[model samples]
Target: MLASASASKAACNQETLNTTSFNYVNDIENQTVHDIAVKFNRGVCDIGRANLMVDVSVVPNVGQTIIIPGQVCHPDWTTCVIDGPGTNDCLIGGPRLYYTLNGDTMWKIAGRLNMTLDAVTCGGDSCNTNITCIDGICPGGGGSQYTANETIPAGQFIKIPITCDIEPYTFSAGVYKDLAEKYGSTVGQIQMLSPTYNYSYIANEGGTFPPIALAKNCRLLSSNYTILS
Candidate 1:
């Protein structure tokens, strides 16, 4: 797995976003958007929005055509880090659209993204208005937005407020401080990812540590990026 990951990274480096164009493929194996993104070393949201998928996480029908966009790294892959408001933890390049799946709610979605409900909703910035509704029927308009937590019906694509991209990692044998130092993260940030853990206690052998988002270059997104930045 390590060898394959390295090769994929090498392949990704060879392809630049400026020179690469859209690549088309057929879902003969019945793959999801995530699967295609991993196979092509692109971001899931990139392929999802490019194909205008109502549910980015859903698997495409067999033989359906999918469009893969050119991206330098997976949306969750952080390239570099910059000084930020909190602890200088790594943040994603920009916010990515999260399409609601069945049984999705505000609290559940926030937890999956490892974000506080308040941060997910309006972390220091006002809520974004550019929502793309599925089924061609928008809920609210004319200065009134549908907003979060109201039914949160499936197939709705909402812009996730920009936050750090978290990757799950298991600690070999160390306390929170050791893991944080190894990953260039802070203890407070690590605790946020796995709040139940006792940071001071040494982790049990083979016990998996909480997920962490490594630092990366965070080029703030402008207001006008159509799908993703």
Candidate 2:
């Protein structure tokens, strides 16, 4: 009787260990699906029936599709279809839309959105403030306007005004120094206004320096800066 009890206890421990390992594996697989969705710029549901399989592992490549068999949940395991890919009718969530001004400091975008730059970028290394034009176009009617401090909704297309000139010459560092020397403004203050250049090669070529507009309220000390074409 003592040997039998010990054998039963060992079996129970093994079962528990197996259960824990299965749960861990399932969690890891779920996370892998989520990460792949984000990386591919596709929706999670797009994985379709292939994502619903149980006791099965799948490795998908870019542009490849797979099918999964549906498994039973806790309440109904018998009725589940385990033979084939379940369904392709998964619905996609809407695209997340946000806005940024070219060459504006990250702090300014965060302040405008009433969110930290870290929050906006999902804590990524890329700077939120230095976003380029191709990120998205200014929405119709000048995009969604917000007060200097407003919390923007996720997936809402924000339209920030392209107030700064795409001056041929001004880069962020140059603008910072120029504003400091001429207007007695600090680099932080100058960066609040978004300054950008229209031509990419000009900025790369180190040609003529252009003056970008200060924010709407900034007073120009000289008439040299032209409105970007």
Best by lDDT: 1
lDDT of 1 at 28: 56
RMSD of each: 18.9, 22.0
Model 2 TM-score on a 0 to 1 scale: 0.20
Question: Candidate 1 lDDT, tens digit per residue, 122-194?
Answer: 4332223443333332211111233345446656655542434466664434333344446554433443444
RMSD of 2: 22.0
| Clash count for each candidate, listed in order shown | 4, 3
- Which pairs clash in the backbone of model 2? 50-68, 97-155, 169-210
Model 1, which residues run further than 4 Å from truth? 1-19, 74-229
Question: Residue 175: error of model 2 in Å?
Answer: 5.3
For candidate 1, list the clashing residue pairs, or say none. Answer: 80-216, 80-217, 81-216, 81-217
Q: Which one is best on TM-score?
A: 1
**TM-scores of all models?**
0.28, 0.20
